[model samples]
Target: MKAMIKVTLKNGVLDPQGKAIMGSLQSLGFNGYDNVRQGKYFELDIEAFSKEEAKARATDMCEQLLANTVIENYEIEIV
Candidate 1:
């Protein structure tokens, strides 16, 4: 089984890296972009009997290490 995970900061959190990227974009003459945010993506292959199991395992992984539950949110897609 394969799991695709996306981890992003929750609203109201400060993103200094995102701000720096936006500033660099503007300096490079890239216009019309209002804001930019950064996130994490992960692709994992694991042993699972079903799609549901894959998702469950992915969710567990996120809760344990992939994401910081207090400030980051995660989504899982199983294939």
Candidate 2:
């Protein structure tokens, strides 16, 4: 099975990197972009038998090592 995980900063979190990107874009003549946020995507190949198991394991991975739970939120999708 394949598992895809997306991790991103939670609402109200300060994202300096995102802000910097926005500034750079504006400097390059990109306009009207009010906001920008960055996130991470991870794809994993696992030996789970079913989508449910893959989802569970991926969720555990996210909680254990993939994301900083204190400041980030994650979502898991199994394929």
lDDT of 2 by residue, 1-79 (tens): 8888999999999999999999999999999778698999999898988889889889899999999999999999888
What candidate 2 gets wrong by more than 4 Å, as runs, is none
By summed lDDT, which 10 consecutive residues of candidate 2 come out lowest?
Answer: 30-39
Lowest-sum lDDT 10-residue window in model 1: 30-39
TM-score of model 2 relative to the true fold? 0.93
RMSD in angstroms, candidate 2?
Answer: 0.9
* Model 2 Cα shift for residue 32 (angstroms): 2.9
Q: What is the C-alpha lDDT of each candidate?
A: 0.93, 0.92
Q: Which stretches of candidate 1 lie over 4 Å from their true place?
A: none
Q: How many residue pairs clash in each candidate?
A: 0, 0
